[model samples]
Target: MSGPSPAPAASDGITPLQQMVASCSGAILTSLFVTPLDVVKIRLQAQENPFPKGKSFVYCNGLMDHICVCENGNTKAWYKAPSHFNGTMDAFVKIVRHEGIKALWSGLPPTLVMAVPATVIYFTCYDQLCAVLRVRMGDWAQEAPLLAGAIARVGSSTMISPLELIRTKLQSQKQSYRELTDCIRAAVQSEGWLSLWRGLGPTLLRDVPFSAMYWYNYEKSKSWLCERYNTKEPTLAVAFISGAVSGSIASTVTLPFDVVKTRRQLELGELQAKNLSYQVSSSTFSVMSRIVAQGGFGGLFAGFLPRLIRVVPACAVMISTYEFGKAFFRKHNQERLRGPLQTRNT
Candidate 1:
């Protein structure tokens, strides 16, 4: 036998209502986790200073930096663990209090639209890549899985990058995008069609390794959970715990890339400049070299702590919620189909 599943795994019999609530909570959680870093990354890309003074809504994460205490030995930025830890709850408060329920769904459309097809592509391509790897290396332990995940993620990221780019711009605004079409038009008219993928380099930079770890760790943990604990086969709690774990691991591997991509996309002239650099790769290298020379590596990972804080829990919540909601909806529909037949027979 495989094993017994856990105590809370039974779920007290999950209801559609609870699942739906959990899902909405989850999405908001991820967005909260990601946005502050999103702001910082974008600003960095735009070539602006990561931390500007004031309570501006655009990037209000001055908490990531240090207060410059008079320590004799040296200066090291302390991780504001408490502040970072509270990001999800804070997001919940902001949404419920300020904008109400509608705000919870703010990034939903784009997320749904972007994530689904990309997932399809990633899985399909990953399976194929793994099949090839199986032939070539027979599940060779070290770097093979990482390479496969990276390759698969690259294709998905390319397709999804445009919508993702628009979503970022849309969410950051006090007024969200008038519509997806309008967002597309505005991005193109101003920045050219290519601008939709402004931060693509960084995205792939983060995704490849992240995807590998996500799948590898998730599969291992889930199998273990199912085997060792009384995990509910299909319940919000399990998904939540699994997703949170997944997000946390993914965040660490992909954070640096997220930082770079944010900076690339945020910078206004970067898209056109990058396009121009295609004709001159050497020139592009020189420009990046100059930026590093000026700012040092810290410029690259600016606001990472805030981002890590925001994203890890948010990811856990959102993904878990989404999956559980989907399961609940499917179950509800099946029950509805059976109810009429039972009533008619009775």
Candidate 2:
């Protein structure tokens, strides 16, 4: 009998190009789905003053121009819209009714622009770094995901931080800038170039730890689920569940830093909007202390509910979509290789 045909060469799992494509797709979908939640969350977290009910005020969040009635004392939005949101559900209803549905997607343009590249860099780097570190660490490979996730987050967050600053400004503003460039020009002229990177320090503090925890938990959860299900690779369900659990835990733990980051960025945006020369403090701890003094310890956890709600689904959708996309490309590549090999055998 003829010797068994040589085993087919193992296909490289997924190329960086494939990873980028997958990550881009996931980012766009996640932004579209979660932006409304984000808008409400920011509005809640950034509101320092209360609006009395039935007060009509001019609302200009992103491109929206409307007169909104504040139904609750707690309602606020980008540009001090009079429609006061009492909570997450209230914010959703008021924003939709007063500003129209499109207002829910305020800041979507900047978010998409920022998210696509950021997610691509973040996810692809994490995957590549994990692979490299796992091999290099040998017996210590189990810790690779934690280090790789943190490193990837630091790199990606630093690169896209300017965009993040812009996005937050767009989302939180109550006034209409003629265009995005107008906002950028105003900020640069007033605050100088370094203004673009405002809040980056708090961003890194929040994100690096969140990334490390998220990836560590996600890997462990995915592995356990896969083993339980007798699957060699993670399924969409596995990815979704793992991501949701990991994201919820990380988001909760890192929320206080998120609150600080929002306050810092919003202070800058407000200063730029009003053409004020006053300097805002950049100390994260200072902000935290002020928050505690103002709202008590509860202040540090502002918007916790909406944030948790947003993060759970956002993580599930983004990660599952990314994994599915990567799996698709991997299968396509393997099939392409198989076709040539089979033809050669014949």
The candidate that achieves the highest TM-score relative to the unseen native structure: 2
lDDT of 1 by residue, 1-346 (tens): 0112112212324443444454454444455555444433332332322222211122322111101111111122111121222344564554446545444433234454454455546655654565455456643633444566778788878987776656554443323446656857876899888877765765566677778887556545554666667654535565667656876788776665655544443342232222233333323244355456778766555666766666556555555655555556556766887899999999
lDDT of each: 0.50, 0.72
Clashes of each: 18, 4
- Candidate 2 segments whose C-alpha is farther than 4 A from its true place: 1-12, 38-106, 165-196, 278-280
The TM-score of predicted model 2 comes to 0.76
- Winning candidate number (lDDT): 2
Off by over 4 Å in 1: 1-151, 162-199, 230-235, 269-295, 322-346
Give model 1's TM-score versus the native structure.
Answer: 0.50
Clashes of 2: 4
- Local accuracy of candidate 2 as per-residue lDDT tens digits, 1-346: 0011111112246888898999889988887787776667556644645445433332222111122334343444343444556887887887788878888777576446666888899998998888777767878877778998999999998888776655555544444656777878888999899888866788798889989999888888887887788776679999999999999999999989878876765555455454565465669999999999999999999979866777788888898998889879888988998999999999
- Scored against the true structure, residue 136 in model 1 reaches a CA lDDT of 63
